[model samples]
Target: MTYATPPRRTLTALTMTTLLAGGLLLGQTAAAPDASAAGGKKVVCEVDKMRQQSHSLRARAARLQRLGATAEARKARAQADALDRRVRACVDADGNAPKPWN
Candidate 1:
């Protein structure tokens, strides 16, 4: 009786496949953020927080406009626009004005 070993080509292919799978796993792990401490808290990234604030300000401005406080409403809208721009910048740190939250 005798035992047969895998051919050289077969071993090579299996090793390459293993290496490729390991690389993919490492790549995915590196791309994901650690969520250990963020279990309970809603982790709003910087760009998202700016977007939410801008949205809230816009709503406030609309309410003020409905209430007849035109001047204050304009000011609030201006602030909101500025914050929106900040969010855009965060989304596209480059000079190119790419739509941030759409």
Candidate 2:
């Protein structure tokens, strides 16, 4: 028995898929360095901002406590704690906080 050839459309589709996959891989590798640089800067800046906010929240909690606003103080402290956790998670691989250039 003779083996039948693959249909034309199937071969075309397979070729197109392979080309598209290759193009995507090439594009990603080509852009990766620049993307990481830009994204790293942005992440550092954002984490810095979050750290500042968390600090301010803790201060606010302290002030509220002084004013005898126990409930509000608790809330502020909780928010600050949550922000601290998120900042920790976003810290660099070396476990250092991101230092923004600016």
Candidate 3:
């Protein structure tokens, strides 16, 4: 049998980080979004998702212009951009507050 090393505290920390990253990815995979986590670090995660989606939507809208699908592309891009802006506003407002996050 091969000798295996026992887990240490550092391994626990690494596991926590991996789990957190996975949760963020899963949270962003939903179409409706889990805004329930908005009070914590998950807000940051949502901001990242919104930013990524906005960038992708913008790029797709630009490509659509070349394909002459401007109207639909622009509409969808507007929605994505609105979500991105809201996410940014949440980030800015959260950091500006002077109260607890209960």
Candidate 4:
């Protein structure tokens, strides 16, 4: 009587296939915030989130600058500026003009 074990490559392929299937299933079931479910305040929530993100990015940019990473700091500042513009537009659309950040 004899039994055979799968080759190393076969086992590796099987493991990878199983992991890929599991990842796909998880991605399909992931939940995200829904605008329609927010009762008309979705934009406000989004603007607030953007504000927080921009603030963090700006802080990171400052830290990067102090660390002498000019290119990375510039990138972070650019992203922060973009988010600030979007936040301003969102606030203006809501009829409440945004003030400059302190």
Candidate 5:
């Protein structure tokens, strides 16, 4: 019995698939460092801004509490908490500590 060779179309398809996969991997590796650096910087800046906003919100909440606007104070506090959580998530995603605000 003789073994049958693969059709030309089948061989062409396999070769194209291999080349496409290799090109994708190479493109990703080449782009990774620049993308990460830009992304990291953006995350750090965002986290810092969120931290500042959170602090302002907390102060506003305290002032509202002093003036007997308990409902407003609570709302402000909740906003501050959400901002804090957002900052934490950004820091975690960035994989580094954010720079101190100047």
Candidate 6:
């Protein structure tokens, strides 16, 4: 029995896929230092912005709390708190929280 050769389209597709995967791996591994700036420090700045957003959300929650709808206020507060935790994690880069996350 003779082995059949792969179709041209299939061979081309595989080559393209391999090249794309290789490019992605290289991009992730040998990322430029100036861009990422060591341990994703640039992302930490983004984290700060996200945390500020969470603070704003919490502020809205506080306003609702002041309006005496305690249940809705608690829900909002909890959502804000979760965002705050995520932002803190982004800032810390190793699942650590910043001081005064509350």
TM-score of each: 0.47, 0.47, 0.48, 0.49, 0.50, 0.43
The Cα local distance difference test for each model comes to 0.83, 0.86, 0.79, 0.85, 0.85, 0.77
Q: Which digits, one per residue and each the tens of the lDDT, describe model 6 over residues 1-102?
A: 975567977898899999999999999878746545566654334666677777887888899889998888888888888888876666566546455756
At residue 22, give the lDDT of candidate 1: 100
lDDT of 5 by residue, 1-102 (tens): 975567977898899999999999999998766645555664344777788899999999999999999999999999999988877777676776566872
The lowest-lDDT stretch of 10 consecutive residues in candidate 5 is 35-44
Please, what are the lDDT tens digits per residue for candidate 2 over residues 34-67?
6465556644437889999999999999999999
- Model 1, 40: alpha-carbon shift in Å? 32
Among all windows of 10 consecutive residues in model 6, the one with the lowest summed lDDT is 35-44
Better lDDT candidate (1, 4)? 4
**Collision pairs in model 4:** none
- Backbone clashes (count) for model 4: 0
Q: What's the true lDDT of residue 95 in model 4?
A: 70
- Runs with alpha carbons beyond 4 Å of true place in candidate 4: 1-45, 96-102
lDDT of 3 at 3: 46
User: Which numbered prediction scores highest in lDDT against the true structure?
Assistant: 2
Could you give candidate 3's per-residue lDDT for residues 59-95 as a string of tens digits? 8888887899989788878978798888878888788
lDDT of 4 by residue, 1-102 (tens): 754556877888899999999999888778644547346554444877889999999999999999999999999999999999988787777776566782
Error of 4 at 44 (Å): 6.9
Off by over 4 Å in 6: 1-45, 94-102
Q: What C-alpha lDDT, on a 0 to 100 scale, does residue 100 get in candidate 2?
A: 81
